[model samples]
Target: MRTTLYGQFVAGTKTDEVKQIVDKFKQYNVKVILDYSMESDISTSITASNNVHKSSFNTELDESNTFKIYHPDERIFNTNMFNYIKNSNTSRELCGQSSFIAMKITALVRPLVLQKLNQFLESRITDHNLFDTIDSLLTTKNDFTHSLTPNELGEISNLLLRINRIIQTVKKNEGRIFIDAEQSYFQTAINKIVIHLQRLYNRNNLLVYNTYQCYKK
Candidate 1:
């Protein structure tokens, strides 16, 4: 690990070690942006037929139905969320106030699910009500899970929880977060989530940002 690109670009593996490097940069007035490097394990293509379950939002879901769609294991996702919260807190402490942290939506939610959601959103891109439905979900004022299957809704709920935790940590520390933009296939879903977060948090301060790639078509 110490002989290749990972060794050269990665700050360090441990918190203390990374802090040492960050401290050096701090001496020169350079702020550090910490990002967990974990990527989703799934890379298969999404199909149009795999649309979200259109059942009523209050419909009860059976255990068998949970895995009928794309969803990561509960333990794994929770662990990642915990690590994200802890890492962000540590990052804030290491870098001091107004620190910056980078996050990937793919890290919290399955990529295939994102693709499916993106496909659904793109299909309804011209519908103003669809956007209003999404906007209402920012503060949980209304239920938007009606458009998603129970499994997809659960996954999205978990993702929102994870992101909310991270956002609260960053806010308490007076730091900002940058949500990384992914491939075109998933960018639409990512943008929606980030924008909602921006609406909730940026109303007072620019605590959240969405990244745009110039190279994407």
Candidate 2:
């Protein structure tokens, strides 16, 4: 019960057969963090795309007929398929199974949306990069607004929905969601959207969590 670990000790670390562990921790009045160790479950990929892997990936896949040999980008979502994750995580969370979701804004929002928002943030009051540059981006469906190819556009759209769904889940269950940060080259871009989401969703409290990687110059 009285543990000692600096790093965030994930929930599953205690072990699935945790009746004794739970009882011991309860005696000590210890708090617990929800961390599902289903590393294989969420937005991850199965490596070794050989016949075995290919056959395995196809197992239980709904689109059996549509399945074909495709590149990784085509097969998987730019940041883990949203529909698959929504269904998977939703079920996992409901089972009192997984908690403490560590996700990325990049996984959900299109890079170009961040790019446009970052660009506007840098413009001076008179820098004349019309507000639409960023404003429309927020209002419009980011999935269809980018200059990427048709297939790329669809992939990007999946990410937007994935983000929306993730937030909806966090909001529904009052769960904590952490949005991890990246390099300085991306802070502004990440910040712009994160703040927007914060203001939109985090009015009462810090709903959209943003990580600041402080190792940069």
Best by lDDT: 1
Cα lDDT computed for each candidate against the true fold: 0.72, 0.46
Sliding window of 10 residues with minimal summed lDDT for model 2: 36-45
The residue-by-residue lDDT of candidate 1 on 83-111, one tens digit each, is 77777888888987858888888777767
Candidate 2 pairs with clashing backbones: none
Off by over 4 Å in 1: 44-72, 133-148
Clash counts for the predictions, in order: 0, 0
TM-score of each: 0.79, 0.50
lDDT of 1 at 15: 87
